[model samples]
Target: MFKPFINTLALSTIAIATPLIIPIIAPAHALTEAQVLERLNGIPVFTITDDKGAPLLGSAPQKGSEKPPQVLLFFLNPDDAQATLTQIQKTNPAVGSKARIVIRSMNDAYEVIKKNQDKKDIAFQIVPAKASIESARTILTSQGKPADKLPNVPVFFAIGGKDKEQGLLTLEQNGKQLVPFFFDQKDLQSLIDRAKQQQPDVANATKIQVTSLFQVLDSMVATKDNKPNPDTERFTFVPSRNAFEYVVKNQPATTPAPATKK
Candidate 1:
């Protein structure tokens, strides 16, 4: 079925092995790039480029724009959508990030990510990226991809309206284990404030090895070597404004709540 199996849209995805087995594998690809992009939620900014690559509509924020959308990107390794949610809350705290955040990892899970959405409060809106390398490169550059800095799985990006990577945040934990670390609100706050700092130009984004969230993002994407997992995560639904009341009640004013969550 590999050849002449389906349409010309080449579909490739990364998957995690679960304990359970499926009696029958589904037809078509498990993670379709188009389907993933449809599930995202937020202010919903996009670029409608012409055939020659000119913007028709739906552009991102440009420099010197005060109201530009704040965007954060999480590149997850093990690529579990459920685990993806916890990491976002811990690092970015969905409730107060004034910026829009998107988590991209290995594709191949719809129900898995969706189930988590029903139960927990995913602080920010989620959106999948273009599954393939070429398409993804286009979206990332709709702003600009720091091919020099970010590299591989678990890369985080803090982007402006024009889609430039202002602050890139990366994480090391494999999907869900992020719970214990982020549980402490005070500690988490410190990291959030730290994300605001500007990163220096990566000497060689492609050659860089990832140890921290920021370094990985700055290195990996800059190289443009690794292709993002096809099943990029996107927000299907978002929480209401009432969501942040809990944070306000518990955290001190020093809390770096850049924006409100759900």
Candidate 2:
């Protein structure tokens, strides 16, 4: 029983806001372990660790279970991890001061989880950025759909096609057409705006679609062998630029060598 923890408030919000079309987004299909891990590669996730570089674990009570399960928190945004660290520092300075943020690809985390899948003591939980969640909710509401159907971090993509049928919009890069899914809504919107200016005809038909990171990963696994077009295999995930910048800025400063005595 590997349970991914979602806080009570967020869980309640998801319950009320999830649209009826969730099943369509995340179809109930069995995916092999290799498929799952292959899809997770290159996606970055953040975590907090002690000075010794071990992930900090937290326990949350599980319904119908006597003992609360231990959870390792994975953050979509470095800022969120920093916020958690700040709070820990306020309450427990000694422990917090020694804690640091670590960046790892989602595949790296999944590999570890897969190795310990049989163990019942711990589970991995994803902590989405509040801003991203709010953006997703707003988009869903505007479309007259459920506000928060995504289970994990929301991914935004643009779609446009002829008639009733629609498909992901592709952008040309280095002579290649690539479909981009963004972790940040604002980034996706920016691309949408540029596309609109460049192709007015296509812009009028463009629509923004929202899905969860987990759903996207699962979809890759499900569709791996049956891609409708070559471009479908070129799907690219665009991480939050701000989060990347934060990681670079906070990287441990390199130690300088002592100068020889004059």
Compare the candidates by TM-score and give the number of the best one: 2
* lDDT for each candidate structure: 0.25, 0.61
Off by over 4 Å in 1: 1-167, 172-190, 194-262
For model 2, the superposed segments whose C-alpha errors exceed 4 Å read 1-41, 161-166, 222-231, 251-262
Count clashing residue pairs per candidate. Answer: 41, 0
Deviation of model 1 at 207, angstroms: 21
* TM-scores for candidates 1 onward, in order: 0.17, 0.75
lDDT of 1 by residue, 91-184 (tens): 6564223322222221212222333333322211223222322332433555455533322211122212112322122332334111111111
lDDT for position 104 in model 1 = 20
